[model samples]
Target chain A: DVKVTQSSRYLVKRTGEKVFLECVQDMDHENMFWYRQDPGLGLRLIYFSYDVKMKEKGDIPEGYSVSREKKERFSLILESASTNQTSMYLCASSSSGAGWGEQYFGPGTRLTVT
Target chain B: ELKVEQNPLFLSMQEGKNYTIYCNYSTTSDRLYWYRQDPGKSLESLFVLLSNGAVKQEGRLMASLDTKARLSTLHITAAVHDLSATYFCAGLMEYGNKLVFGAGTILRVKS
Candidate 1:
């Protein structure tokens, strides 16, 4: 079984503060993704890393960035937290092997930016 | 731009009832996935449909994909209260393996 772990399950930050959400996967998957889920909006990708030090912007990357210094860990950074940034964040990892490669997700972190 | 759409955003069904949720994509995709998410929780992968006419079943839930039509369906048979959750269908775009997820269907099963 694959396991993805998030650094925090719940977090609260004041406006204008910086926040970090961490995700680590035991499967050593090559692809890691960060997504924010909102009601009626589904899961929108914020950033993704295909390899160490390589990152790509997804649909909703504004005000957010990502880091992939190692194969097993991916980090999401909120430059300046705001009330609107409060939401559930999810991290997923997938392999580069055969087929499209099913994604394994972490438990998720619900961030509250006040 | 690849787009995924799910029909009937909300559904309330009685226990032991059956229903189907539809997912449609705007373009070609390499694969499709069905995932279940509980409130304030992460996603649990339910099924992965890889080809046209592909079908996969687990428990009382079955997923089918029609690549030619860019459509997927998740059918629930004799659903139970414990099965209540938000179901999302995601399509892997051909180019970069980026997943595009539908808005999701919220299922409420009652006794």
Candidate 2:
């Protein structure tokens, strides 16, 4: 079975603090994505990387950035955490070659900024 | 821009009852996906509808896609407590691998 692992399941940070959320997939998928889920807003994409050192901004990329240094690892960085940024973050990975376009998600990281 | 919308954002049903969740998309899409997410847990893939008039079923849940209408429906038959969760429908755009998701339908089933 494919597994997507997140560095933290729960995190609390102060306003103006820098935060990092890590995601690693064992499936060697070429595409990795970061999304923030909010009540009523649903899941909004923040950033995605198709390959190492390649990244693209998604629908809701403001206040967020991403890093993909290795094939199996992708990271989401919050330059400066704010109270409004508190939400559940999800990481997903998919292989383009599969042609299925189904994303396997990691257990989400619930972040609370105070 | 691609937009996905789901109707009946909140649903409460009794056991053995039937319900349906609707997903509508704004533009053309290469595929549609259905996912289930339990409270405070990760999403689990349910079905992938790749073409027009596609219908797939698992257990009591059936998903169908109509590309021309840019619509999809997930029908739940005989609801159960274990099936209570948030259901999300996502549309995969033609341009990239990005998926635009709809506001999920929160289903509460009482036995």
Which candidate tops lDDT? 2
Q: What is candidate 2's CAPRI-style docking category based on DockQ?
A: high
Q: How close to the true structure is residue A93 of candidate 1, measured as C-alpha lDDT?
A: 93
Query: What's the lDDT for residue A59 in model 2?
Result: 82
Q: After superposition, which runs of candidate 1 have C-alpha atoms over 4 Å from their true positions? A: none
Expressed as tens digits, the lDDT of each residue in B1-111 for candidate 1 is 789999889999999999999999998888999999998789999999988999999999999999889999999999999999999999887887688899999999999
Q: Which consecutive 10 residues in model 1 chain A have the weakest lDDT in total? A: A95-104
lDDT per residue (tens digit) for residues A41-67 in model 2: 899899999899999998889898889
Interface RMS for model 2: 0.9
What is each model's TM-score for chain A? 0.97, 0.98
Computed on C-alphas against the true complex, the DockQ of each candidate is 0.79, 0.83
Where's the lowest-lDDT run of ten residues in candidate 2 chain A? A94-103
Per-candidate Cα lDDT values, in order, are 0.93, 0.94
Candidate 1's chain A scores what TM-score?
0.97
Q: Which digits, one per residue and each the tens of the lDDT, describe model 2 over residues B1-111?
A: 888999889999999999999999999999999999999999999999999999999999999999999999999999999999999999987787888889999999999
For model 2, name the residue pairs that clash: none
